[model samples]
Target chain A: MDDNLMNKLAILAEGAKYDVSCSSSGVERLNNGKGIGNARGWGICHTWSADGRCVSLLKLLMTNSCVYDCSYCVNRLSNDVPRASMSPEEIAMLTMEFYRRNYIEGLFLSSAIEKTPDDTMEKMYRTLDLLRNVHQYNGYIHIKAIPGASSDLIRNCGYLADRMSVNIELPSRESLKLLAPQKSFEKIMPPIENIRNNILLYKDERKSFKKTPKFVPGGQSTQVIIGATPDTDRSILSVSEKLYSDYGLKRVYYSAYMPVNEGPNLPSLFSAPPLLREHRLYQADWLLRFYDFSVKELFAGNSSSIDSNLDPKLNWALNNLHLFPVEINKAPLEMLIRVPGIGHISASRIIRERRVNFLDFERLKKTGCVFLKAKYFVTCKGKYDGESLDSEFIRRKLLNKMDYQQISFLG
Target chain B: MMDYLYDGTFEGLLTCLYYNFAKIKATGIYRTDTYQTSLVNPHVAITTKEQLADKMYEKIRKHLGTYTLTDLYYCFLSEKDGFENILLSFIDLCFRNGPVYAGYHTHKEVIPFDDIVGKVKREVQRYVGYVRFKAVGDVLYSEINPEFFILPMLASHFADRYFNEKIIIHDAGRSLALISKDGKHFIMPYTETDLPGSEKEDHITNLWKEYFQHIAIEGRINLKLQRNFVPLKYRKDLVEFSKPK
Candidate 1:
């Protein structure tokens, strides 16, 4: 490659590194035989970063030059950082080159508002158009939906991209106004809601036609910058709950606020990022999506913040001591999944495996349950392990067994 | 007590099971290659008969569905120590209870077989993600040193993914290779010298290595997480971990 292209790539990739949404799953598009690449149902992580995040796509920005000056962004317009912008053709060529080398699954193109939101969005749309129509690249492409861009431009970009995201960087409208004055939830929520309605509409169209082009088949996701503002966990999750219920979002990403720029509105550089809180929110999100958990169940009586020592599921189990000692052999599938030690897959396995025989402790252990943690709350063959139903002792025992400080990237 | 022994092929195992089921009152069954020799007990070598193996397999498929039988076959592929005895006992239970034993997860005899099958399936699934292909000339070549005999299991996956290109997946651990061309694939006994690196292969490999090193975040360096995802055992064949040729 030429020196100009290389310089642009280095700056653009570095600028896009902290977005933390490089996933390439939830859509399976077969290569049209003429196309160069295909998207698998389960996304392939070509490699991992040193931080252990999966690098599935060539995640990069179209340009770092911006018109809006967000306080938390590295590519804020007022910053003195080096700025470079790739033309739509240059970005398309780079994606094809990287993809052919098997360096990435596809493209994750996000950009700062260079001239205006519509101007920046049109540049991104042209990049996607060239990749899809001109280059015939049929791989996974995730693009950012510029919050203030026109509905027509957003709809056009949604047609060509596999997934679209509009980041709710700050939790509340007040935070958006105070820090990111140019952006607001009014501008952000409209585009997200539009994509959701269009995706549903396109699904209905394709049911009869059978050849209609997919409109954001992977669905839309939004990211919230946690710990940047004074928003509580309850408030954050409530927004997520509303997003899921009203907008039908596929995912809501939580990014622990990594201090990037210094401003009076932003958090101090000395404070650590809330990595543990982000992880707990993800665990809670999984519960909502797969484990049939309601938002009210988590914050029903006293707590809004997730317990740091135990996982969200275990924490909930310990607090509701009246619901303990659930019978493993006879508990329904929904109740079984609510158990701390039994995950979605294992709970299903238990349901499947228990049909033919009466389940005992050994059988439950063999079914992939976290047998040690589960022994306290579950009874097999009417026999429980703990001497008493003392919640504090059980909590302490679990804490002694698990080191909550050590976080797994699997979460 | 009598001991029945046979070669370690699946057919050999089936033949041994057949003999114990029909001809002999054997106390224990063993694969002759893996079992230690002992002068205390009398051991008889059982020759594999294709017809008898076929009959035993038919009986198994009749008692349990093909899904359960495939699970048992995967357990056999695991090649772990004393897996033959476990298979024999599992098959015996299948015959006695006529499908209840296979369905019942809590049965003492069924749990060990379930464990082995689960282990084999997990290894197979991991290799699906862990297998990395290096471009050598027109063929996309990858070499794996998987713990299980998983080359056969990986045939349909790679074939579907790379339908237009010729591909070869070599299992270096077992000296086996599954080669596909024109959308068709099959496995054969392979040696080290079968694959010849293309001229530009080194350049592409270096490019991949460059991308791998630069992609990791400097602020959040977690070797523990990296090791957890790409285990040290399978890193030998991975392009990021391997030294350039």
Candidate 2:
């Protein structure tokens, strides 16, 4: 553990930590022979940060020394912080050595503002270029899109990296203005828009040509720092919905803001970034993406914000009682999945199995639907036995049940 | 008292049932890893020929269905006392009751086998969540001596994300597991049969090096939580966090 290697590791890992795009998504791969490692289909990374994220990759800093002082950053030139940087060959060698030893799934190379965006991003790109072309490293590589760098470098990076992320760190331009005066929304949006158009263009070209262009096969994903600005859940979600729909982003990661720096107007690190609220938004986000639940139905009776006590879907079901008591035997897959205790797998199984024989509540337990939670929401053969789905009553009952379980477990 | 011994195949296990029902003074049944008694001696060992094993495997399949065959495999893997008697009882149910209980929930004979399989599944789930990896050059390395026979099918889980990397998995207990590279993989036998080092070695045994490098959250040091999940017994060949050996 030389002081130099340790410093390079620390500075780079810390710089990389602020980026929230390390997810290894899609179906997992088998560890075939001749490769250095394998992916767990269920995606098991070794450890997680306090905010519940996986750390499988050798997530580290290429360099932490920054010339530009972004308001949201602690490693800015004006701020007093230890600095370190890894050379291009050093970064690529470390990544290969780590990959060979099964220390990481791949490399997630990022850098703070080193000398210039061109020089720093060029250093970053060169390391990836070495790993890809020289070493023939084909493992997962996630690189950060250097802000204000020319589109040519960003475009070239998109070809080699498995995933590329340009964080919309602040929610709106006003927040960006107040916090990060040096950065602009205009500087950010174009790369995303260009990447989207270019990704489509590459796909079209590949469809007709023998040589397929390697254009960000995993597609582009971005991160949003939650509670950093005065943005509502609605505001953040509206932006996320737009990112998914408009720019064609793969994932819109929600990172709970950690105020590592101090200022008068800047947020303090005391109030734990609403983890539960973040969780609610993730569920509601899933509902919109997968479950066909509109954002409006989620906010029908309540105010714009998400409920902290109950899960968003269950919260919606409580208000709309008439929709429930849908028969598990005959209900559509859409409605069946909405019922609590029934996961997507169980719903599909029900749809398939019910074709052969009528499914009753007793048999539904073995059918994989959790009857304990689903009992209140669903019925079989017209058997409905649950209290009315009034919001207050359901809320009290659910919370009381949770409290009872917790107290008894503690005792 | 007589010890009815059989060959080292699953059918040889079922053959024990065939012989056991002929008499009642059955006691002290154990796998032939060690221990010899004057009563049965050792020569009477019955071997589960590939044909016989397949035949009995098919019998369970015909009467008890596919999942019951799964139960039988796990029941044999359990290494519990009187598992033979429990298995014999289950076979008796296949004969006594009809084939309705093959996939049926409310049946008499399937409960014990079901219980054993459930326990195995729990261990599987825990291993799935808790399994960690270490890189050795280009090959990722993992070693586990699980309480059950689970390593053969675990590769399907880990290979996707590591598509370009190669990995090796060793079953410290069974002495062999698997080594996969590129996209090709094969299971090879291993044993603590050879000497590495005892628990007295200093520094990481390669795996410890991997685990130390794996942690990104240095601030969240919860050894109690890690120990609770990993347990002390399974930590020996882990190489990374294990005490010098």
Candidate 3:
């Protein structure tokens, strides 16, 4: 490894330390008949990262010498910190070496603005280029696309990478202006639009050739930092819901801000992006994606923004009481997902597995499910174990529990 | 009856097993290194003879499920000493239960056996991410003593992945490997080598210098909890926790 390569890797990797996109992973790392291993899980499987993300991947930065002055970024040019840049050859070689010994099954490559926008993008493309062409590495690779890169570079990146992301640092353009003054909302939209169109083009071609080229086969995703600026979870989820609606993005990572590079404009670390707020946004976002709960259906309800005390599902279930008491044996898959404690996969599994037998909590638990909160709203063979249907009482109980967990942090 | 032993090779091992069932009392056995045997038993080193192994396969197949036998093959490749124990356990399980394992039939998907394999795979994973190698001269080394014969499983994880950088992952338990890059790998009947454990310092950065101090919020110093994740055994090998010379 060259000195420049090591330097670049250190800067960018240190810069990427703040991202929390490790949990929302479905990408399994498999070998191509030559590499070391794959990411197959077992019963009671546990994973851990530097930040307790617990999933696997060598999450690092491609470079940290950024030309853009995004106030939220540690690698912004004005900041006096050591910077490094990795050549595609160096990056690919490291990934292969680590992969052979099974340190990780994939690479999460992100970079800062170095020199011109095109130069930054060219380096990112070349890294993926070397990983694929020279090394024959057919593995999980998630690359973060710099917003201001040329259209050609963006398209080529989509072709080469398994997943691509462009961080929408703040929720609204108004907040973006206040926090990240150098970044414009307009500069962000073009890439999102281009990736969306390219994904669609690849899908269309796949129907004809069956061997049509893969373009972001793992799909596009982006992150929006929470608590960095004055954006509500309500507003953030709205933007996230729209990103999903418009671009067909696979995931929108919500990073809870940890008051790292604090200044007068930034929020205090004590009152930073409340970790629960990030959790609530993920719940509400899940509602939009899998539960088919619309933004209006979520916001127009009396209890706007998810309940701080109860989970988002419980909050919604309490708000809309009449929708509950649905039979688990009879309810549609959509209604099942809306039930508290019923995840998308479990709900679908319930629908499939129930065809042979009338499903009970016994079978549900066997398939990795908890019906603690769900029992109140759902009945299996007319067996309802929870209390009366006063939404207020349930709401109060849920809130009290949340308050207990939040304040009991000493444990 | 004569027992045979040979340098580690699947064919050689299979050949011994084959003729042991065919030529004499079908009782000839193979062992890796020199050792004593019963007065009635004679021993010799064996090599790959296709016809002998093929005939043995025919007889073993008459009474053994092909899938169960293949699993035995994969498990044997692990070169773990306790492979015989597992083999006995497997043969016992098969005779007692009639090859109820899902992998027995090519058609009926046996998920539970695969799930056990999956459990073993996780052990391989924990070994990979968690193994800490001590650097010595040009090479890095770490010794793992896993419960099962995990050498074959661990071979690809360390060697092929670290192709450019040379590293040795020794199965301290079985002394076996599944390495791809040309390097020293073996399994043996116990010998002694005083491994240099914590000799490398001043070169690698002191581990836990930043993460332990900076990870949690300022006031919450949960040493007990942190220690629980990183056990005491590993600390003895870590340079950060070493007593000042």
Candidate 4:
């Protein structure tokens, strides 16, 4: 609560806000009756910031001082911002106090490279060590894995933290070279690969030995800045697809590039961040992860970017109109989910409820499906609610509804 | 048809249901405190019988299963107007058609019951994040004004998480508090005057406000979006939303 700590918290939080990976989910930890905290598998958002982002953790940096001059980063060495660092003791103390007051689920510890990668990673490791051992904090802890840090240091921190991430920064190696000459896929990929392999190794060991400590039990994730360079949505999503399949990541966060620093290589400071593009990428990413859609399916044709006017699922449905007018009562679960507005939850509910009684148009609405959208693609009990099977008509209707909603929202 | 009135408790409601099944068909069930006199319909005052309530509880569990029973309990906690009539018809339908009737999501009787239960569960989940604790001496204290009687539902989550710390989550609307200390917890009647005034700011809260302000991006200032997530109704007790004196 001192002035020095308050100033450091303000500066460091500002530096870490752009990282945009504030999830505390994927681990269900219980307090041992002696510990002070627990982790819910479904993460809890303590509050929302003015930017509408969830404040799940006390997101902070170990220090704002940097040696690498990444053009996209506000904490680059060339920037003239206030620099402050928190000691391991200070970080641990703050995390405990905030967590005990229920202000946060846990701590999200990230840092700009100070002195060296190993030095920065070591300081972060000590903070986790003190929180987990000395304080017996059983809460969630997500720490950033420094890209160029030694594997030993990364593995040590892995055992103490619930989740870890290494930012891919740019979509492609070419963009990385242009914007951040010091950082590359070569430096970032190794830590991600190492964390993935160690997670598997630790899980297998835990089955054999119950006392084996968890190595990033919440799994590893990575982030890529959107619209930083000339990276297309296709390239970004392909990188994400590779990370999910090859590296076995839990999430791939796509951060809209906010131009905090002025550089010849970066976008203009006056240009708005491509927030809608980032949202479309997230929608496409969900389709890839949960909806069984491939990157090839999302970008089926010559289009290299996602449709900005509609969601990826709806766009895919519109493109593949030959598959529409699906029989709601007879369609398989997989086929049912492919229908627009029918999510996995509603699709399963339809399967379950239909087993007891045949579903009618009225019954399908109660199953939690968005009838307005699904009516265009599905028929219930041989009754089609849509006026026609024309995709153009449906698209216009949906777009008009969306425009109305947006106008009301602005008003 | 006669109206039945009983104490405002889950067991009392079950007892009223038992009486309706045993003696005569009732037009509706009303809580003793909230019951209004009607000129046309005769009313019967049903006494609370724990044994009869237990019998009805076991009957519901045996016939409709624990899932429906849990939903019914949550619906009772919602305290919505005309909820007793909704639950009565829902139970009547379940008894006639067996447990499968509960799965009839589109049924007229089941729809309102599900809506009320869903609202109660959503409020409990929201309060899990919205409850703000303050350090009142050695004990941590928080006050929440929830729409449902959700204090009992929130007991295990806070008790399990803060097992070592003394904590009290007060439901100011219901005048009840969930108090936990040293791995044990209980819900008891508590009033606002029991705790000191919480307007005084501490340095830790000041530090949190500072961090909250600095965490938002300057370029993407979206107060409307923020209001959508943390609505104005919930800002009454949040530390970051409070203005400094």
Candidate 3, position B6, lDDT: 55
lDDT of 2 by residue, A270-370 (tens): 65555556667888888777777776787765577777667777877887878877887789888888886677877876775566457777667776776
| Candidate that beats the other on DockQ, 3 or 4, i.e. the better one | 4
DockQ of each: 0.32, 0.20, 0.08, 0.70
**Global lDDT of each model?**
0.81, 0.66, 0.62, 0.89
Q: Model 4: per-residue lDDT, tens digit, A1-411?
A: 578988999999999999899998999988987789999999899899998899999999999999999999999999999999999999999898889888999999999888999999999999999998999999999999998899999999999999999999898989999989998888988999999999999989989899997789999988999988999999899999999998899999999999888999888989889888888899889888998889998886889988788888888888898988999999998899889899998998788778678999888988898888899999888889999888799989999889876554333
| Candidate 3 wrongly placed segments (more than 4 Å) | A1-10, A22-47, A84-93, A135-138, A262-264, A300-304, A329-332, A344-368, A400-403, A408-411, B1-245
DockQ of 1: 0.32
Off by over 4 Å in 2: A27-44, A47-52, A352-373, A404-411, B1-143, B154-169, B177-189, B192-240, B243-245
Off by over 4 Å in 4: A406-411, B192-201
Residue A76's lDDT within candidate 3 is 70
The estimated TM-scores of all candidates read 0.88, 0.77, 0.68, 0.96
Chain B TM, per prediction? 0.85, 0.63, 0.50, 0.92
Compose the digit string of candidate 1's lDDT tens values, residues A1-411.
Answer: 455666667778778888888888999867666656788878877666667787788888989999888898889989999999889998898777566545578899999888888999999999999999998888889999998899999999999999999999888988898889989878888999889989999989999999897899999999998888888788888888888988889899998887878899888878777778888899988888888887778875866788766788887888788998999989998889988899987887787777777788878888778987888898888999866777899988877777643544333
Whole-structure CA lDDT of model 3: 0.62
Interface RMSD of each: 3.0, 6.7, 8.0, 1.5
Clashes of each: 1, 56, 15, 0
Off by over 4 Å in 1: A2-7, A29-32, A87-103, A129-138, A400-411, B1-63, B98-108, B192-207, B243-245
Tens digit of per-residue lDDT, candidate 4, span B1-245: 89999888898999999988888888999988888998989998999999999999999999889999999999898989989999999998888777888887778888898889988998887888888898887899998888889887888899999989999998888889899998789999998646654433377888889999999998778889999888898898688898886
Per-residue error (Å), model 4, residue A171: 1.5
Per-model TM-score (chain A alone): 0.96, 0.89, 0.87, 0.97
